[model samples]
Target: MDWSSKTVMVTGATAGIGAATALRFAEAGATLIITGRRKQRLETMADVLTSAGANEVYIHRFDIQKKEQIAAVVKNITADTLSVDVLVNNAGLSRNFSPMWEDNTDGWDDMIDTNIKGLLHMTRALLPGMIDKNSGHIINIGSIAGHEVYQNGAVYCATKHAVKAITASLRLDLFKTNIRVTSIDPGLVETEFSEVRFYGDKERAETVYKGFQPLTAADIAESVFWSASMPEHVTIAEMLVLPTDQASATMVYKK
Candidate 1:
């Protein structure tokens, strides 16, 4: 199951699950194509992976919010020198929960654009190459929120739900092709995800993982590896991951 020369691309590669996943693939000897909008952070991550064991590492720094930029990135990556073996659409955004009718427009736009539209743009950009080769894997980082919505999470939930639906749709449409599509839906992960969603409110972000165990970035990273490493004939479709003490989105028990 060694990746040897296979090239894998991961967005949101600067940190969290994407960073961890990139490290895993790099260790397994994959040629890595890592991307994120953050410049220095992404460069530092590539340094770590290069030190680990990656054969060749390429970096693309671009904001997912810019659709044209995403297109340019795809062209650059797919140039004569590079071809993708796997594409992980890990870039996403979440927002604080607020009353739907009481002026939630700002959060709404960010969540919709980053979470939903951004993912779609990346997929469209990269899938043609995968289809041409008749082989590739796509691992999307979805959330339990996609399955069950909580208060103050209207737009976030909507975007994730859209993820769930799109993952299914893409799988169906690509049935004839050997491209693998998977959704790694994690319950609650103690990552920068919460801080961003809570708008840098450290306390509120910390509260999400209080008094209980939550999944970590490495946990989901291993899941992504498993999904990608499966036999060409097997696709792990959708996965729901939670800590042992958790049951569902709203049913986590914390002390």
Candidate 2:
């Protein structure tokens, strides 16, 4: 599992788990291609990665929602290298907490566009190289909601569930190619995830983390690194991680 010479592409690399994961891989001496919509943030991350001993740090300013942009990025990636050793799909969105009957069309579309369509485009765009190379890893950062429904989370949960299912299908589809696929399903991760989901309602976000220590971005980053570093013959098909006090989506215990 020597990552020194390998290359990894991570979406949503500007902050949180994606940023931490990029830092970890860079610290291991891997080359990096990090992408996010924020130009400044992406540039800052590239600098940070270069400072942390990465041999090559590349940044792409593009929106995951744009299929054309994804295709263009993939073309550019192919021009640089025939293949990318690892791909981490971390860019995604969640909707506001509203009942299924509520008129939240925009929020639903956002969730589907990023979580579902974005992931598909990224995978389809780069996976061909991996198949040709016969060696690569794909990590999808999913959530506990992927497996269980939560109040006012129908669309978000559905999108994550799509992720979970796709990871399964990709694993099977790439069996002959030896390209590993894994889904890291995290539970109760304390990050901008909650704040964004609540649309900046600090109290609502805070309540999601009450009475227990939630997993941090770094924790999930470590988990992803571990999954990718495993022997070529091994694949951690899926990983469901939760804080000790939390059991499941609806089973979180509060004091």
Candidate 3:
């Protein structure tokens, strides 16, 4: 439970689940390295983390979609004498909700680039240090979409499905070592996720969570903290979290 000696790197720490997760670790006394594309927000989050009890907070501004940027940041962290004890790959997005044939190609590009490629780049950049030390936890923020494909969300679903595959494969690959890999998939969380998916349409986004008690960013954050705080010998391979009214990706019971 004492994370004072640990260092945790969280991608997409500007808002939502990423921000919540960073704060959770901070409350546990971890040294935090938080990254996001928004410079100002990342800085603000760093300050918040410091105020929340983190031993140290480092803010890095870069798009995870860029491999060079990821590598450069990781290198700088290493140079600073910080060995990451946990890596949270939570930088991801869902662009649109259209059938595969009618969907815009740009949406596809954004989803694939951010959801799949971004996760790979961060893992690739940080896994080396963990392997050399033979200790680390990689917590991926996947989705229920990874387990089931919903109507008009084919590409987004595919990207999450790939997350599931990658998480499994990465765990197996690290089985010989003490490195741990886990995917935390959530059904419905009331956050900016819906707003972003709807291209900033507030009303439309509100409809998605209407008449239902959806999970919050803090809920998922708690799960991440729990998974990372487990005994070194225990590895939780995968966890699927959903709201009480939700059963799966497509089955949400609204009041």
Candidate 4:
């Protein structure tokens, strides 16, 4: 697949699956627009993408939770005469692990704002261009939690469920157009997700992956690349990726 003329925009490109996907697209010779809230990390990723064979690498720092910032960035990109060929909505986080009654309301806000609202903001800002051209692909980074619920993860699961709904609805709404929509839902991939969920408790985060060989950021990235690289007429609408030891969101086996 030739991505020489493609312009790929990835949110949350500072680390984890987002960073991996950016590099994957870079290797395909795409012009890259990588966004993240961390300024330094975003710049570093930009340098790495440039060195990795990206035709052009642009970095933007902004919180996806901020609607105005999303709009401003999209405006800037349009002014530069670049429309995204692929939009990877991967800016998301899990904040806490507790049952609904005991969970922090702040955690609920964070997950809903980032995982649900943030995804909406980006898609709203960029979908119009795709419609005008009648060409593009939107790959949403979802989780198996979207499909199944687990204890102490009600809010997080709810947000992902919203992602599933949004992805499906967007595809239906765009059915008349040539645009494609897909949701890449992974069961588990070792990343900063656990650390953030545990509020920087590194010890606890490490434990989540201690007994098993969890999926890596690169593994999910490969899936994203393949989905976007498929023929325009074909859309791998929804995918559930998990490690061999994992069966479902709540059914991971540990040795």
Candidate 5:
């Protein structure tokens, strides 16, 4: 896969898996379009991407949860004549770790709006360009929760399951075309994920990975890169990545 001429768009590239994935492509000398809600963080990351050997780095600050914002960003990118060769849907999070009955609608709303609707909005906005060019790849960042549900995470799990369905259906929808759709579902990757889910409670987040070696953002980034770089004829439709200490979404070995 020759990345030198490719332009990859990654959502939520300010940190965590999104940042790592963008950096991975940057190392391959790819042009990167990084979008996130944090303007300062995105600006800071542009320099890092440039230093990492990205041919070019463009930062757009927008919250994916907003459909209008996603539309505007896509319009701007198109105006700049930047056609994204690959779109990595990674702007998603779990709001709270609580049972459905105990949780409020606020967390549920956040999870649904960002995880499912945001993904759909971005994909819908950019997919036409791919269809027109007849060349592109859509890699969705999913979770083990997509395949198996866990206790107290019903809503979050549902969002991921929606992602799984979207990926599969998109693949089928574009079967006749050259475009590829894939989902990279990972188990435990220690990032701001737990912290964010716990509402910035660092102590609670720390305990989630204390007893086992969890996957890193870069680990998942590598897998994402591999899946996207495959030959045009071959599509790595789905990849389920888990650490040695983890099996299912609930089965994690603690030492």
Candidate 6:
């Protein structure tokens, strides 16, 4: 694919996999639209992405958990007359590790609102343009948890499972169109993920990858880029990426 002429939009681009993916595309010389809640971080990223060779860089500051915020961002994109060639739904989180019976309702709500509802809102917002143009790609960042359940992660897993289902069903929904949909399901990745999940307990988060090499944000970014770069005739419907030391959500070879 000639990325130089394409415009890519990535949600949650302020950090983690989203930032890496944006940087990857920028290095390919693509125009970029990166959205996140941190205005300062977004500003810094825009400069960094531009320096990384993005043809042009744009940033939108908004909280994905709110539909109003998402709609406002979409309105701005439309007003700017920017047509996104690829949309990466990358903004998501896990609030805590409490099991279902003892989990905070607030945490549950956070996970659902951001992981599931946010994704739906963003996709619905951008999908019409893709359909109207009859050309586009939607890459959803899923997780290994989507395929398996684990203790104390029931709510987070449920959200990702929903992502998996949505991605599959969306492919069937758009089968007749020229548009493409893909899900990139990754295993453990060492980023803010653990810290966020553990509520900023850096010591606790560090132990999650103590004895083995977990995937990095850039590693997942490379997978996302590869999926997006495939021929138009080819659609990578789903991908499950894991560190060699990790076999499943709960099975980590830490030795």
lDDT for each residue of candidate 4 in 1-255, tens digit (9 for 90 to 100): 689999999999999999999999999999999999899999899899999999999888999999999999999999999989999999999987987888889999999999999999999999999999999999999999999999999899999999999999999999889999999999889999999999999999999998889999999999999999998889999999999999988777998
**Candidate 5 on 1-255: residue-level lDDT in tens?**
889999999999999999999999999999999999888999999999999999999999998889999999999998989999999999999988887788877989999999999999999999999999999999999999999999999999999999999999999899899999999999999999999898999999999999999999999999999999999998998999999999889999999
Ranking 1 against 6 by TM-score, winner = 6
CA lDDT, every prediction? 0.89, 0.90, 0.93, 0.94, 0.95, 0.95
Question: What is the Cα-based lDDT of residue 246 in candidate 2?
Answer: 86
Q: Tens digit of lDDT per residue, candidate 2, span 1-255?
A: 778789999999998889999999999999999999999999899999999988799888899999999999998987887368999999987878888898378888888999999999999998878877788999999999899988888899999999999999888788677899999999988878888887788898898888878888989999999999999999999999988888989887788
State model 6's lDDT: 0.95
Which residue runs of candidate 4 sit more than 4 Å off their true CA positions? none
Q: What is the lDDT of residue 94 in candidate 6?
A: 88
lDDT of 2 at 201: 86
> Considering only N, C-alpha and C atoms within 3 Å, which residue pairs clash in candidate 4?
none
Error of 6 at 76 (Å): 0.8
Candidate number with the higher TM-score (3 or 4): 4
Best of the two (4, 5) by lDDT: 5
lDDT of each residue in 57-79, candidate 6, tens digit only: 99999999999999999999989
> Which ranges in model 1 have alpha carbons more than 4 Å from their true place?
102-104
Candidate 1 lDDT over 1-255, as tens digits, reads: 669869999999988889999999999999999988899998898899999999889999998878999999988886847889988889887876567886358878888888889899999998888898898988898989889988777888889999999999999999889999999999888889889887889999899899999988999999999899988999999999999879987898888
RMSD of each: 1.2, 1.3, 0.8, 0.7, 0.6, 0.7
Lowest lDDT block of 10, candidate 2:
75-84
lDDT of 3: 0.93
How many clashing residue pairs are found in candidate 4?
A: 0
**Candidate 1 global TM-score:** 0.97
